[model samples]
Target chain A: EAGVAQSPRYKIIEKRQSVAFWCNPISGHATLYWYQQILGQGPKLLIQFQNNGVVDDSQLPKDRFSAERLKGVDSTLKIQPAKLEDSAVYLCASELSGANVLTFGAGSRLTVL
Target chain B: AQSVAQPEDQVNVAEGNPLTVKCTYSVSGNPYLFWYVQYPNRGLQFLLKYITGDNLVKGSYGFEAEFNKSQTSFHLKKPSALVSDSALYFCAVRAAPGGRRALTFGSGTRLQVQP
Candidate 1:
Protein backbone atom coordinates (compact mmCIF):
# COMPACT_ATOMS: atom_id res chain seq x y z
CA GLU A 1 0.00 0.00 0.00
CA ALA A 2 1.15 3.54 -0.67
CA GLY A 3 2.21 5.43 2.41
CA VAL A 4 1.15 8.93 3.26
CA ALA A 5 2.54 11.52 0.83
CA GLN A 6 3.73 15.08 1.54
CA SER A 7 4.80 17.78 -0.90
CA PRO A 8 7.63 20.29 -1.04
CA ARG A 9 10.21 18.18 0.73
CA TYR A 10 11.88 21.41 1.81
CA LYS A 11 10.84 25.04 2.22
CA ILE A 12 12.64 28.16 3.34
CA ILE A 13 11.19 31.56 4.05
CA GLU A 14 11.82 34.63 6.14
CA LYS A 15 9.98 35.36 9.32
CA ARG A 16 6.58 37.01 8.79
CA GLN A 17 6.23 35.17 5.47
CA SER A 18 3.56 32.60 4.76
CA VAL A 19 4.01 28.97 3.79
CA ALA A 20 1.88 25.96 3.17
CA PHE A 21 2.48 22.21 3.08
CA TRP A 22 0.37 19.54 1.47
CA CYS A 23 -0.39 15.98 2.50
CA ASN A 24 -2.08 13.01 0.90
CA PRO A 25 -2.90 10.19 3.24
CA ILE A 26 -3.03 6.52 2.35
CA SER A 27 -6.00 5.45 0.32
CA GLY A 28 -9.08 4.64 2.38
CA HIS A 29 -7.61 5.86 5.65
CA ALA A 30 -10.29 7.82 7.43
CA THR A 31 -8.17 9.59 10.00
CA LEU A 32 -5.36 12.05 9.22
CA TYR A 33 -3.07 13.99 11.50
CA TRP A 34 -0.60 16.85 11.28
CA TYR A 35 2.33 17.15 13.64
CA GLN A 36 5.25 19.48 14.12
CA GLN A 37 8.60 18.07 15.13
CA ILE A 38 11.07 20.61 16.40
CA LEU A 39 14.74 19.83 16.71
CA GLY A 40 15.58 17.60 19.65
CA GLN A 41 11.92 17.15 20.41
CA GLY A 42 9.17 14.66 19.75
CA PRO A 43 6.42 15.25 17.24
CA LYS A 44 3.56 17.34 18.61
CA LEU A 45 0.06 17.17 17.26
CA LEU A 46 -1.09 20.28 15.43
CA ILE A 47 -4.45 19.08 14.29
CA GLN A 48 -6.49 16.00 13.47
CA PHE A 49 -9.23 15.35 10.94
CA GLN A 50 -11.71 12.55 10.75
CA ASN A 51 -13.18 12.51 7.26
CA ASN A 52 -13.08 16.29 6.75
CA GLY A 53 -14.45 17.23 10.13
CA VAL A 54 -11.95 18.35 12.69
CA VAL A 55 -11.57 16.02 15.62
CA ASP A 56 -8.99 18.09 17.45
CA ASP A 57 -7.07 21.33 17.09
CA SER A 58 -6.55 22.45 20.65
CA GLN A 59 -2.80 22.35 20.28
CA LEU A 60 -2.69 24.30 17.03
CA PRO A 61 -1.48 27.88 17.11
CA LYS A 62 -4.62 29.33 15.64
CA ASP A 63 -3.24 32.81 15.43
CA ARG A 64 -0.65 31.82 12.90
CA PHE A 65 -1.63 28.38 11.67
CA SER A 66 -4.59 26.98 9.78
CA ALA A 67 -5.32 23.58 8.28
CA GLU A 68 -8.06 21.97 6.30
CA ARG A 69 -8.87 18.55 4.92
CA LEU A 70 -11.51 19.40 2.36
CA LYS A 71 -12.39 16.00 0.91
CA GLY A 72 -11.16 13.97 3.83
CA VAL A 73 -8.38 12.40 1.73
CA ASP A 74 -5.87 15.21 1.48
CA SER A 75 -4.87 18.05 3.81
CA THR A 76 -3.02 21.34 3.78
CA LEU A 77 -1.38 23.23 6.64
CA LYS A 78 -0.58 26.89 6.37
CA ILE A 79 1.45 29.10 8.64
CA GLN A 80 1.07 32.81 8.06
CA PRO A 81 3.55 35.29 9.43
CA ALA A 82 5.80 32.39 10.14
CA LYS A 83 7.81 32.79 13.25
CA LEU A 84 11.46 31.87 13.60
CA GLU A 85 10.32 29.21 16.01
CA ASP A 86 8.07 27.69 13.36
CA SER A 87 11.05 26.15 11.64
CA ALA A 88 10.57 22.41 11.96
CA VAL A 89 9.48 19.34 10.09
CA TYR A 90 5.80 19.09 9.30
CA LEU A 91 4.68 15.48 9.35
CA CYS A 92 1.50 13.90 8.03
CA ALA A 93 0.17 10.64 9.39
CA SER A 94 -2.84 8.48 8.76
CA GLU A 95 -4.65 5.49 10.19
CA LEU A 96 -7.63 3.33 9.56
CA SER A 97 -10.56 4.41 11.60
CA GLY A 98 -10.43 2.72 14.99
CA ALA A 99 -7.03 1.18 14.17
CA ASN A 100 -4.09 1.34 16.52
CA VAL A 101 -1.17 1.72 14.12
CA LEU A 102 -0.34 4.91 12.20
CA THR A 103 1.61 5.34 8.96
CA PHE A 104 3.57 8.54 8.44
CA GLY A 105 4.81 10.50 5.44
CA ALA A 106 8.34 11.62 4.74
CA GLY A 107 7.44 15.14 5.99
CA SER A 108 8.06 18.69 4.79
CA ARG A 109 11.00 20.47 6.32
CA LEU A 110 10.64 24.20 6.83
CA THR A 111 13.31 26.71 7.66
CA VAL A 112 12.47 30.21 8.76
CA LEU A 113 15.18 32.79 8.60
CA ALA B 1 -4.17 13.86 29.19
CA GLN B 2 -1.53 11.33 28.13
CA SER B 3 2.22 11.77 28.32
CA VAL B 4 5.37 9.82 27.48
CA ALA B 5 8.96 9.97 28.66
CA GLN B 6 12.19 8.72 27.12
CA PRO B 7 14.61 9.01 30.02
CA GLU B 8 17.69 8.51 27.83
CA ASP B 9 18.85 11.11 25.39
CA GLN B 10 20.94 8.48 23.65
CA VAL B 11 22.01 4.85 24.00
CA ASN B 12 25.23 3.39 22.70
CA VAL B 13 25.96 -0.26 21.99
CA ALA B 14 28.44 -2.19 19.90
CA GLU B 15 27.33 -4.08 16.85
CA GLY B 16 26.04 -7.59 17.61
CA ASN B 17 25.43 -6.63 21.23
CA PRO B 18 22.06 -6.39 22.87
CA LEU B 19 20.30 -3.02 22.88
CA THR B 20 17.56 -1.54 24.95
CA VAL B 21 15.69 1.81 24.84
CA LYS B 22 13.53 2.73 27.77
CA CYS B 23 10.09 4.38 27.67
CA THR B 24 7.40 5.18 30.22
CA TYR B 25 3.93 6.66 29.87
CA SER B 26 1.08 8.15 31.86
CA VAL B 27 -2.57 8.18 30.88
CA SER B 28 -5.93 8.52 32.50
CA GLY B 29 -7.30 5.30 31.06
CA ASN B 30 -6.05 2.09 29.48
CA PRO B 31 -3.06 3.14 27.39
CA TYR B 32 -2.06 2.20 23.87
CA LEU B 33 1.69 2.30 23.64
CA PHE B 34 3.82 2.53 20.49
CA TRP B 35 7.43 2.79 19.37
CA TYR B 36 8.65 4.46 16.19
CA VAL B 37 12.02 4.96 14.51
CA GLN B 38 13.06 8.02 12.55
CA TYR B 39 15.98 8.14 10.21
CA PRO B 40 17.70 11.43 9.52
CA ASN B 41 15.49 13.78 7.47
CA ARG B 42 12.71 11.21 7.46
CA GLY B 43 9.34 10.74 9.08
CA LEU B 44 8.61 8.25 11.82
CA GLN B 45 8.16 4.58 11.01
CA PHE B 46 6.05 2.38 13.19
CA LEU B 47 8.00 -0.21 15.12
CA LEU B 48 5.36 -1.88 17.28
CA LYS B 49 2.34 -1.24 19.43
CA TYR B 50 0.89 -2.67 22.61
CA ILE B 51 -2.88 -2.54 22.61
CA THR B 52 -3.68 -5.73 24.43
CA GLY B 53 -3.28 -9.51 24.47
CA ASP B 54 0.47 -9.90 24.93
CA ASN B 55 2.86 -8.11 27.20
CA LEU B 56 5.71 -8.76 24.76
CA VAL B 57 5.14 -7.43 21.25
CA LYS B 58 7.54 -8.01 18.36
CA GLY B 59 7.87 -5.50 15.53
CA SER B 60 9.78 -4.54 12.42
CA TYR B 61 13.55 -4.87 12.03
CA GLY B 62 13.90 -7.50 14.72
CA PHE B 63 12.67 -5.13 17.44
CA GLU B 64 10.50 -6.03 20.38
CA ALA B 65 8.93 -4.11 23.25
CA GLU B 66 7.77 -5.36 26.60
CA PHE B 67 4.79 -3.66 28.13
CA ASN B 68 5.00 -3.65 31.92
CA LYS B 69 1.77 -2.34 33.30
CA SER B 70 2.98 -2.17 36.87
CA GLN B 71 5.95 -0.08 35.87
CA THR B 72 4.05 1.86 33.22
CA SER B 73 6.90 1.16 30.85
CA PHE B 74 7.35 -0.07 27.29
CA HIS B 75 10.99 -0.70 26.55
CA LEU B 76 12.27 -1.54 23.07
CA LYS B 77 14.76 -4.38 22.90
CA LYS B 78 16.85 -6.25 20.40
CA PRO B 79 19.11 -9.24 20.87
CA SER B 80 21.75 -7.98 18.43
CA ALA B 81 22.33 -4.43 17.36
CA LEU B 82 23.42 -3.37 13.89
CA VAL B 83 25.01 -0.18 12.66
CA SER B 84 21.91 0.45 10.62
CA ASP B 85 19.90 0.50 13.83
CA SER B 86 21.43 3.83 14.77
CA ALA B 87 18.64 6.38 14.60
CA LEU B 88 16.12 8.26 16.67
CA TYR B 89 13.47 6.31 18.52
CA PHE B 90 10.29 7.83 19.92
CA CYS B 91 7.79 6.53 22.41
CA ALA B 92 4.15 7.51 22.13
CA VAL B 93 0.93 6.91 24.01
CA ARG B 94 -2.79 7.63 23.75
CA ALA B 95 -5.75 6.72 25.86
CA ALA B 96 -7.40 3.56 24.67
CA PRO B 97 -10.97 3.66 23.30
CA GLY B 98 -12.05 7.01 24.67
CA GLY B 99 -11.47 10.71 25.02
CA ARG B 100 -9.00 12.19 22.52
CA ARG B 101 -7.32 9.64 20.29
CA ALA B 102 -4.25 11.55 19.20
CA LEU B 103 -0.95 10.28 20.51
CA THR B 104 1.36 12.19 22.82
CA PHE B 105 5.03 11.55 22.12
CA GLY B 106 8.15 11.72 24.21
CA SER B 107 11.23 13.79 23.46
CA GLY B 108 12.88 10.80 21.70
CA THR B 109 16.06 8.82 22.28
CA ARG B 110 18.90 8.58 19.79
CA LEU B 111 20.40 5.09 19.45
CA GLN B 112 23.99 4.76 18.28
CA VAL B 113 25.06 1.26 17.35
CA GLN B 114 28.81 1.28 16.93
CA PRO B 115 30.30 -1.01 14.38
Candidate 2:
Protein backbone atom coordinates (compact mmCIF):
# COMPACT_ATOMS: atom_id res chain seq x y z
CA GLU A 1 0.00 0.00 0.00
CA ALA A 2 3.02 2.26 0.09
CA GLY A 3 3.38 4.89 -2.61
CA VAL A 4 6.25 5.29 -4.99
CA ALA A 5 9.36 6.62 -3.22
CA GLN A 6 12.14 8.81 -4.55
CA SER A 7 15.35 10.03 -2.98
CA PRO A 8 16.85 13.53 -2.65
CA ARG A 9 13.75 15.60 -3.19
CA TYR A 10 15.97 18.47 -4.37
CA LYS A 11 19.35 18.69 -6.03
CA ILE A 12 21.70 21.37 -7.31
CA ILE A 13 24.65 20.90 -9.63
CA GLU A 14 26.90 22.93 -11.87
CA LYS A 15 26.77 22.70 -15.61
CA ARG A 16 28.77 19.75 -16.96
CA GLN A 17 28.52 17.97 -13.62
CA SER A 18 26.84 14.61 -13.23
CA VAL A 19 23.72 13.86 -11.22
CA ALA A 20 21.67 10.79 -10.43
CA PHE A 21 18.13 10.23 -9.15
CA TRP A 22 16.72 7.12 -7.57
CA CYS A 23 13.21 5.70 -7.48
CA ASN A 24 11.59 2.85 -5.56
CA PRO A 25 8.24 1.98 -7.01
CA ILE A 26 5.20 0.53 -5.27
CA SER A 27 5.54 -3.12 -4.38
CA GLY A 28 4.06 -5.59 -6.87
CA HIS A 29 3.95 -2.96 -9.59
CA ALA A 30 5.19 -4.25 -12.93
CA THR A 31 5.81 -1.07 -14.80
CA LEU A 32 7.97 1.98 -14.00
CA TYR A 33 8.55 5.27 -15.74
CA TRP A 34 10.73 8.37 -15.58
CA TYR A 35 9.58 11.80 -16.69
CA GLN A 36 10.95 15.33 -16.79
CA GLN A 37 8.86 18.38 -16.10
CA ILE A 38 10.25 21.79 -16.91
CA LEU A 39 8.80 24.78 -15.19
CA GLY A 40 5.33 25.65 -16.48
CA GLN A 41 5.23 22.49 -18.60
CA GLY A 42 3.75 19.02 -18.32
CA PRO A 43 5.89 16.02 -17.52
CA LYS A 44 7.66 14.56 -20.56
CA LEU A 45 8.29 10.87 -20.75
CA LEU A 46 11.98 10.06 -20.57
CA ILE A 47 11.87 6.31 -20.30
CA GLN A 48 9.60 3.42 -19.41
CA PHE A 49 10.31 -0.06 -18.14
CA GLN A 50 8.24 -3.18 -17.84
CA ASN A 51 9.87 -5.23 -15.19
CA ASN A 52 13.63 -5.47 -15.89
CA GLY A 53 13.23 -4.72 -19.58
CA VAL A 54 12.78 -1.35 -21.24
CA VAL A 55 9.49 -0.75 -22.98
CA ASP A 56 10.23 2.68 -24.43
CA ASP A 57 12.97 5.29 -24.33
CA SER A 58 12.68 6.95 -27.70
CA GLN A 59 12.44 10.44 -26.20
CA LEU A 60 15.40 10.10 -23.92
CA PRO A 61 18.63 11.98 -24.65
CA LYS A 62 20.90 9.09 -25.33
CA ASP A 63 24.05 11.20 -25.31
CA ARG A 64 23.57 12.54 -21.80
CA PHE A 65 20.87 10.61 -20.03
CA SER A 66 20.56 6.96 -19.06
CA ALA A 67 18.38 4.88 -16.76
CA GLU A 68 18.26 1.34 -15.50
CA ARG A 69 16.01 -0.93 -13.49
CA LEU A 70 18.31 -3.82 -12.71
CA LYS A 71 16.13 -5.95 -10.50
CA GLY A 72 12.90 -4.37 -11.80
CA VAL A 73 11.81 -3.05 -8.42
CA ASP A 74 13.99 0.06 -8.18
CA SER A 75 15.29 2.44 -10.85
CA THR A 76 18.00 5.05 -11.27
CA LEU A 77 18.16 7.85 -13.81
CA LYS A 78 21.46 9.53 -14.49
CA ILE A 79 22.46 12.63 -16.38
CA GLN A 80 26.08 13.21 -17.21
CA PRO A 81 27.50 16.60 -18.16
CA ALA A 82 24.31 18.29 -17.17
CA LYS A 83 23.31 21.45 -18.94
CA LEU A 84 21.25 24.42 -17.90
CA GLU A 85 18.42 23.15 -20.04
CA ASP A 86 18.36 20.01 -17.93
CA SER A 87 17.10 21.94 -14.94
CA ALA A 88 13.72 20.41 -14.19
CA VAL A 89 11.82 18.13 -11.87
CA TYR A 90 12.35 14.40 -12.44
CA LEU A 91 9.36 12.27 -11.56
CA CYS A 92 9.08 8.51 -11.03
CA ALA A 93 5.88 6.55 -11.42
CA SER A 94 4.69 2.96 -11.37
CA GLU A 95 1.70 0.97 -12.52
CA LEU A 96 0.42 -2.55 -12.19
CA SER A 97 0.83 -3.40 -15.85
CA GLY A 98 1.08 -1.96 -19.31
CA ALA A 99 -1.23 1.00 -19.89
CA ASN A 100 -2.47 1.00 -16.30
CA VAL A 101 -2.92 4.16 -14.26
CA LEU A 102 0.25 5.58 -12.74
CA THR A 103 1.03 6.50 -9.16
CA PHE A 104 3.85 8.97 -8.80
CA GLY A 105 6.43 10.07 -6.28
CA ALA A 106 7.15 13.59 -4.99
CA GLY A 107 9.93 13.96 -7.62
CA SER A 108 13.46 15.31 -7.52
CA ARG A 109 13.89 18.96 -8.42
CA LEU A 110 17.23 19.62 -10.11
CA THR A 111 18.75 23.04 -10.47
CA VAL A 112 21.74 23.27 -12.77
CA LEU A 113 23.92 26.33 -12.45
CA ALA B 1 2.15 11.54 -33.82
CA GLN B 2 -0.31 11.94 -30.95
CA SER B 3 -0.52 15.29 -29.16
CA VAL B 4 -2.70 17.29 -26.78
CA ALA B 5 -3.39 21.00 -26.49
CA GLN B 6 -4.65 23.06 -23.58
CA PRO B 7 -5.86 26.34 -25.01
CA GLU B 8 -5.93 28.31 -21.78
CA ASP B 9 -2.88 29.06 -19.72
CA GLN B 10 -4.96 29.81 -16.64
CA VAL B 11 -8.56 29.97 -15.49
CA ASN B 12 -9.98 31.81 -12.51
CA VAL B 13 -13.37 31.04 -11.01
CA ALA B 14 -15.17 32.09 -7.86
CA GLU B 15 -15.95 29.41 -5.32
CA GLY B 16 -19.32 27.68 -5.81
CA ASN B 17 -19.30 28.60 -9.50
CA PRO B 18 -18.87 26.21 -12.38
CA LEU B 19 -15.42 25.77 -13.88
CA THR B 20 -14.02 24.37 -17.11
CA VAL B 21 -10.53 23.82 -18.53
CA LYS B 22 -10.37 23.23 -22.25
CA CYS B 23 -8.32 20.57 -24.02
CA THR B 24 -8.08 19.19 -27.56
CA TYR B 25 -6.17 16.28 -28.98
CA SER B 26 -4.84 14.95 -32.28
CA VAL B 27 -4.33 11.28 -32.88
CA SER B 28 -4.46 8.69 -35.64
CA GLY B 29 -7.08 6.32 -34.29
CA ASN B 30 -9.22 5.83 -31.21
CA PRO B 31 -7.69 7.70 -28.31
CA TYR B 32 -7.25 6.90 -24.65
CA LEU B 33 -7.71 10.19 -22.85
CA PHE B 34 -6.59 11.15 -19.35
CA TRP B 35 -6.60 14.08 -16.92
CA TYR B 36 -4.08 14.65 -14.20
CA VAL B 37 -3.58 17.23 -11.44
CA GLN B 38 -0.38 18.51 -9.93
CA TYR B 39 0.19 20.48 -6.76
CA PRO B 40 3.14 22.84 -6.64
CA ASN B 41 6.45 20.99 -6.27
CA ARG B 42 4.68 17.65 -6.44
CA GLY B 43 4.26 14.91 -9.03
CA LEU B 44 1.23 14.39 -11.19
CA GLN B 45 -1.87 12.56 -9.89
CA PHE B 46 -4.41 10.80 -12.05
CA LEU B 47 -7.76 12.52 -12.04
CA LEU B 48 -9.69 10.31 -14.45
CA LYS B 49 -9.54 8.61 -17.81
CA TYR B 50 -11.81 8.02 -20.77
CA ILE B 51 -11.29 4.70 -22.48
CA THR B 52 -14.70 3.52 -23.65
CA GLY B 53 -17.98 4.44 -22.04
CA ASP B 54 -20.30 7.37 -21.68
CA ASN B 55 -19.19 10.74 -22.94
CA LEU B 56 -19.06 12.12 -19.39
CA VAL B 57 -16.51 10.65 -16.96
CA LYS B 58 -16.39 11.57 -13.28
CA GLY B 59 -13.23 11.53 -11.24
CA SER B 60 -11.69 12.36 -7.89
CA TYR B 61 -12.15 15.70 -6.11
CA GLY B 62 -15.59 16.19 -7.61
CA PHE B 63 -14.18 16.65 -11.09
CA GLU B 64 -15.51 15.46 -14.42
CA ALA B 65 -14.59 15.69 -18.08
CA GLU B 66 -16.65 15.56 -21.22
CA PHE B 67 -15.15 13.70 -24.14
CA ASN B 68 -16.29 14.90 -27.53
CA LYS B 69 -15.19 12.81 -30.48
CA SER B 70 -16.46 15.26 -33.04
CA GLN B 71 -14.38 18.11 -31.66
CA THR B 72 -11.48 15.91 -30.54
CA SER B 73 -11.77 17.61 -27.20
CA PHE B 74 -11.93 16.46 -23.59
CA HIS B 75 -12.59 19.40 -21.33
CA LEU B 76 -12.40 19.11 -17.55
CA LYS B 77 -15.37 20.46 -15.63
CA LYS B 78 -16.78 20.84 -12.14
CA PRO B 79 -20.25 22.04 -11.24
CA SER B 80 -19.13 23.85 -8.10
CA ALA B 81 -15.56 24.97 -7.67
CA LEU B 82 -13.68 25.05 -4.40
CA VAL B 83 -10.54 26.87 -3.31
CA SER B 84 -8.84 23.59 -2.61
CA ASP B 85 -9.28 22.70 -6.28
CA SER B 86 -6.66 25.23 -7.27
CA ALA B 87 -3.86 23.39 -9.04
CA LEU B 88 -2.27 22.72 -12.42
CA TYR B 89 -4.21 20.39 -14.68
CA PHE B 90 -2.89 18.48 -17.64
CA CYS B 91 -4.68 16.67 -20.45
CA ALA B 92 -3.15 13.71 -22.20
CA VAL B 93 -3.93 11.27 -24.99
CA ARG B 94 -2.60 8.04 -26.39
CA ALA B 95 -3.30 6.62 -29.79
CA ALA B 96 -4.35 2.99 -30.05
CA PRO B 97 -2.63 2.56 -33.38
CA GLY B 98 -0.07 -0.22 -33.35
CA GLY B 99 -0.95 -0.77 -29.71
CA ARG B 100 1.34 1.95 -28.40
CA ARG B 101 0.75 2.85 -24.77
CA ALA B 102 2.80 6.00 -24.26
CA LEU B 103 0.86 9.13 -23.38
CA THR B 104 1.21 12.54 -25.04
CA PHE B 105 0.55 15.41 -22.67
CA GLY B 106 -0.52 19.02 -22.97
CA SER B 107 1.42 21.98 -21.60
CA GLY B 108 -1.00 22.27 -18.64
CA THR B 109 -3.74 24.60 -17.39
CA ARG B 110 -3.57 26.41 -14.08
CA LEU B 111 -6.88 26.64 -12.24
CA GLN B 112 -7.45 29.33 -9.63
CA VAL B 113 -10.54 29.25 -7.45
CA GLN B 114 -11.35 32.37 -5.45
CA PRO B 115 -13.32 32.33 -2.25
Q: How accurate is candidate 2 locally (lDDT)?
A: 0.92
At residue A34, give the lDDT of candidate 1.
98
| Model 2, position B2: C-alpha lDDT score | 84
Query: In model 2, what is the error at residue B59, expressed in angstroms?
Result: 0.5
lDDT of 2 by residue, B2-115 (tens): 899999999999999999999999998898899999998778999999888799999999999999999999999999999999999999998763233667789999999999
lDDT by residue for model 1 (A1-113), tens = 88899999999999999999999999999899999999999999999999999999999999999999998899999999899999999999999877788899999999999
Candidate 1 regions exceeding 4 Å error are B98-100
* Docking verdict class for candidate 1: medium
Each candidate's number of clashing pairs is 0, 0
Tens-digit lDDT string for candidate 1 (B1-115): 7899999999999999999999999998788999999999889999999988999999999999999999999999999999999999999999988334898999999999999
In candidate 1, clashing pairs total: 0
Q: Report the number of the highest-TM-score candidate.
A: 1
- DockQ, candidate 1, comes to 0.71
